[model samples]
Target: MFAGAVRVGTIDRVGIALSGLCVVHCLTSAIMLAVLASAGGILVDHRIHAIGLVLAIVLGMVALGRGIVEHGFMMPAAIGGLGLGVMAGALTLPHDSGEVVYTIVGVAILALGHDLNRRAVV
Candidate 1:
């Protein structure tokens, strides 16, 4: 049981870190796009967003799913799901400011969910 908890904790930490990175990437990409119109686009490619979204979905599922099972709290999972949905929806929209806004909002909400999940475990 202790070992399982430790593993889950590690997963939660990684999910949290990844969520933070997603935020940083969104913000930095936006700023870069504004400053360096030509080169910045390269930095904020669709592939990068796709990769981040994939990681977020996978990690969010593992950590949040475990937390929900252990704590029996659905809020964390609900929030995380909503965040993931928003992030995924961003991909379907035009790759403009709207997409950036959605990504930022989604990542922030997802990170909050991860935080909640971590707390629930304790």
Candidate 2:
């Protein structure tokens, strides 16, 4: 799906877009759950979070890994790895136990890493 973007060195941009989507999903889920009691099942599904995290990890690894290889720098990949770890940790939190906060922070960090990766490449 993102072949063209990746080939054109826009992987970081794609990662940033995914990070934005993750943030939107997190906020929307929180709002939906608060506003509609019946929205819990769909919005709070663990599978969704798991899938999102996996996507982030794969994209981060690819983009940051390539960035490090090209620029001979590891900071972007390190930061991305740390962000992925935080996001994974969020999954371990109990419901209503500040999971959203962790996820959002992780996503933000991940986006920053992608931005750094882009800069390194340039």
User: When superposed on Cα atoms, how far off is each prediction in RMSD?
Assistant: 2.0, 2.8
Candidate 2 backbone overlaps, count: 0
Looking at candidate 1, the ten consecutive residues that score lowest on lDDT are 1-10
- Give stretches of model 2 more than 4 Å off: 1-8
Local distance difference test, candidate 2: 0.85
Candidate that scores best on TM-score: 2
- Which digits, one per residue and each the tens of the lDDT, describe model 2 over residues 1-122? 33334563588999999999998988888888888868865977999999999999999988988887777789988998889999999999965539989999999999999998888875
Weakest ten-residue segment in model 2 by summed lDDT: 1-10
TM-score of each model, in listed order:
0.88, 0.91
| Residue 55 error, candidate 2, Å | 0.6
lDDT value, candidate 1, whole model? 0.84
Error of 2 at 9 (Å): 3.9
Candidate with the greatest lDDT versus the true structure:
2
> Cα lDDT for residue 1, model 1?
32
